[model samples]
Target chain A: MRLKCPANFRIVRLPCTGKIDVIHILRAFEKGADGVYVVGCMEGDCHFKSGNFRARKRVEQAAKILDKIGVGGERVKMFNLSSGEGPLFAQYSIEMDKKIKELGPNPVKVALQAKKKAA
Target chain B: MIIASKKPIEEIIQEVKDYKRLLILGCNECVTVCEAGGKKEVEVLASALRMHFIKEGNEKKIDEKTLERQCDHEYLEEIRGIVDNYDAILSLACGVGVQFTAEKYHSTPLIPGVNTCFLGANEQRGMWTERCQACGSCILARTGGICPISRCAKRVMNGPCGGSSKGKCEINKELDCAWQLIVDRLRDLGRLDDYEIVAPIKDWSTERAGGPRKVVREDVQV
Candidate 1:
């Protein structure tokens, strides 16, 4: 049951994945996060009825906005798994870590660093 | 209400690329209801634009503000103090709001962030359907409260035209034929006999053909 996920990741807990908004995802990248992924309750398993579904849509919206703004949408993702799937959760984290590493640092973060250097 | 949709980020960027200080203005009226240009939309857009400019190595000062209503002079006046700070204003309100805001602030360039679609009703979350064309006429009572001028592809008066089949418009299978809806409503009301009355030629002059119509309410004037 004990699995080691990537140490580079940080988790922000929400009462429900549905609580996640597009701005929250965008703000992650704005604050220099290399990648962001949301893990919601399994499809149709959300305690709040359609919370997971709403989360999925918002995640998609955030990804689209990221794509439109020149940041690869692939950097963000949503995964639905039941609460008991701890192993699967770790696996997903590792997969996302690999994907974000491949994509490299978020362009926004790099730009912010450059701006700071110039100042 | 007036329904609108966001302009593509690429087109919006092009419109304000020349400016340094920018204000992404939003309206809390119909645009807000339609989920087009609301306070939330202003934040999202501001974040996107900031990222765009940051990545380009030419970061600009982008600000956000949502007015109670941009179409009114009072709401437009709310920004008067901060108006001079921005080089240009990217208005996320409907076209009417944009025009009204521009009219009040003569010098600042007012750029539209959303394409004003039509007078519409929100069918559901994220779904809007055109309902009125502001044709300067009211015939809903005769048509059983459905507007043919706005719903019908051809705007026929007494219709169920050749293009209508199986309650659908030939122009778009997804669209319900306005006449079919009208006829069904009349029949339901036991007033199908009204369908026999031929409609007279419409007064085109009352519509947009009259050119930029205005109404003056003397009693409402302060």
Candidate 2:
């Protein structure tokens, strides 16, 4: 159960959230992530100005791909928060927990296909 | 880049059901970029197949590795010792990559995980659109840089035929007439008269019809 917690997310902290790329997100899902959500700095508040903007776009692209391949793109999400938004961070986790609960286990796990080679 | 789609999970599982030993191969090239085949995809596929077998009361062992470029000889050579370990190889690369994998490992069965599609461009993030046919010739420069062979339904080099309607192709209402794009581009460059030149019926002699083509560059020789 601990593995499925929002805290189980192996956070790859970046100097700025803008450094996160969509490839990373897709790779995460491919690694069996039940869901992925990028926490980025609030707009107009990014320390790197436009870095957060690029991160947002990357997350969106990853989400679209996840959607296309029947992985439920909603499983991949993005949230904007400031460095000191403790309450918001907690809220995001709680919301993620609920969303994962709704999604249940990963589809790949549920759709495990077995081989039937001759004995 | 060429785009391909992975077969349905059930379909792939069914296709490989008869194999007792399987080697799941991944490619780090085109299919990887298109989100079809890659290290991560191989993991997911392996995990899914394993789970399926266990669920059906039959357990099996599946091995996996990502080749740098299976189409290249050196990379294929890297897997030599273990190639004989598996009865069948599941290739998660494009068609060319799969063919090369089979060529190098003649005794093992090679199965493709992806349905190779046409050459395309990522028009938007996660969205791919076909843009080229590789008809073995070049005509874009004369048609205002838009590929008539690929963009036009009829591959017409003389501009829109009677099928063109209101700057759109009659075949596909959503498609903008390729000739319309050509004329518009020519007009923008103040060279609309360039469209007046009728191209001669293409000499198929220089293309694939001529024979298998090869490029030998002395400077790039190994």
Candidate 3:
């Protein structure tokens, strides 16, 4: 099947969504990702039984941490979809791309760019 | 174990906002089990603080460390060499750990990151409830191993107060009456006759009423 997503769109796969931790999501932002989203198995359908559920909780917690640091929590999100949902994955990519576009470049990235120019 | 919860991020931010270099210290004992002040929590907090400072357009350095146990002086000494490098120490331990850390490092300011809740048992994952008050008294044997001092809201010894109804305490309908539990346990143990003997007034001196307390074992003294 031909996969279609924005050229800039990046996907980081994991053995299971539960393997995705808060630090991974935050590090993406620290390293200048405008946004990060986790695609996990549908609720209760996780092969690991509760991996997706755990991923959702970690996403929510990571968002709160972002909000506490003046970074809008909406930049990160978790979406549930089965492995066969290729079209849905593209749709989520489009949706996230649009949201990130509206939010513009990540402030951390902008700050780094400015620092580079100053030095 | 000692139960605790993290303070609001805003409160922690306010405490360390003026400092450029800060250490986020955690304890691996009770706070770790409670998910309040463990290594994982330290990473989260350090990242949040860094993000906050970045958002404020300020350069800050936040370090993270988790001691084996913060309340013990030996564990605290591990940071003695590096303590002077930071402006302040943010302790994620219980109140005891915070106080001990502060007392040991008198020159550096110590900030508490968690509000020590109580001496309780972990009912389950993410759930804790108070169990012991450390009143320096143990009446569990006479009361069928049910501690009225900690379990009962009123700490009644002779019998349940008039507010007890259908085995529930008056303070909260959901709370089981301590005396009622004692009576039932006594029946199960075939010691219901012990309930007939009324307990006398407890001596508060054994507890905090005698001011700060300590236990010195002369035999163990070096």
Candidate 4:
């Protein structure tokens, strides 16, 4: 089925959100993702038992790390939803897209662009 | 193991912001297991620093290096060949490793990336509780393996101080009174009589009270 989400929304699926490490989120920001959000299984419903729980904690840590790096923690988020929640997934995508639009391009990318222009 | 927690990224950034070339040093032993100064942490911190500098429109040459164990002179010497390339070193080891690294490279600035918290056991993932204080004494055999020096709020040898109620320390209700734990353990081991014996005054001279100390074994000398 087609994902009814914004064209700019890029989805990288993980077998379980627990596989999403802090480095992954940090790298996304470093690689110019204006915003990054993890959609994990609903609380206590993870197929991998505690994958969602672990993912939530890692996301919280990644958000803090982002905040420390001057990126503002709001740029990274974690959401819990089951696999059957197709509409919710669409909603989250739209919500994240709007959030990024408000935040504008990632500051890191903006700086790189400015540097390129000057060169 | 030596427990540690990462320093606030904001504080770390502030400390090394002026340095263009910085090395993020990680330790592979205790810090790695504690999830503080491990190899993976080096990557996370380095990535965060690089991202921050990119956003600030500054050129930052952040490098990563993970030594087998930063507290050893042999491991620290491995960086000598490349130590001159960086303006600063961000050590993610325990405080011991940071000091040792600094001592080895006296001219280079070595900043601690983690706050060395305690000698403790990881109760579970992400949770650590102090287990030993290195008081230079081992009384576990007589104390039924419950250490008052480290677990006790007051470090009283004969205790369950008047302040202890319901097996908890009065200082903090959450803390289990060290004496209480010792009594229970001794009772379970059928050695309740041991609890009645008063422990002699500890020799504090062997502890930090004696100032910096060292052990040089002539038999082990090469």
Worst 10 residues of 3 chain B by lDDT: B50-59
In order of appearance, the predictions have TM-scores of 0.97, 0.68, 0.96, 0.95
Better of 2 and 4 by TM-score: 4
**Candidate 1 per-residue C-alpha lDDT over B1-222 given as tens digits, one digit per residue, 9 for 90 to 100:** 999999999999899888999999999999999999999999999988888888888889999999999989888999999999999999999999999988999999999999999999989988999999999988898888999999999999989899998999999998999999999999999999988988888888879989999989999999
Better of 3 and 4 by lDDT: 4
Q: Which residue pairs in candidate 1 collide?
A: none
In angstroms, the error of model 4 at B153 is 1.8
Decoy 3 TM-score against native: 0.96
**Pick by DockQ: 2 or 3, better one:** 3
* Candidate 4 local lDDT, A1-119, one digit each (tens): 68778988678999899999999999998888899999998998988899999998999999888887788789989998988999999999899999989988888888888999999
- Residues A26-103, model 1: lDDT tens digits: 888878888999999989889999999999999899899899889879999999999899999999999999999999
DockQ of each: 0.77, 0.10, 0.63, 0.86
**Ten contiguous residues minimizing lDDT sum, candidate 2 chain A:** A110-119
Tell the DockQ for candidate 3: 0.63
What are the interface RMSDs of all the models? 0.9, 6.8, 1.5, 0.8
Best-matching candidate per lDDT:
1
Candidate 4 residue spans exceeding 4 A from truth: A1-3
> Looking at model 1 chain B, which ten-residue stretch has the lowest summed lDDT?
B197-206
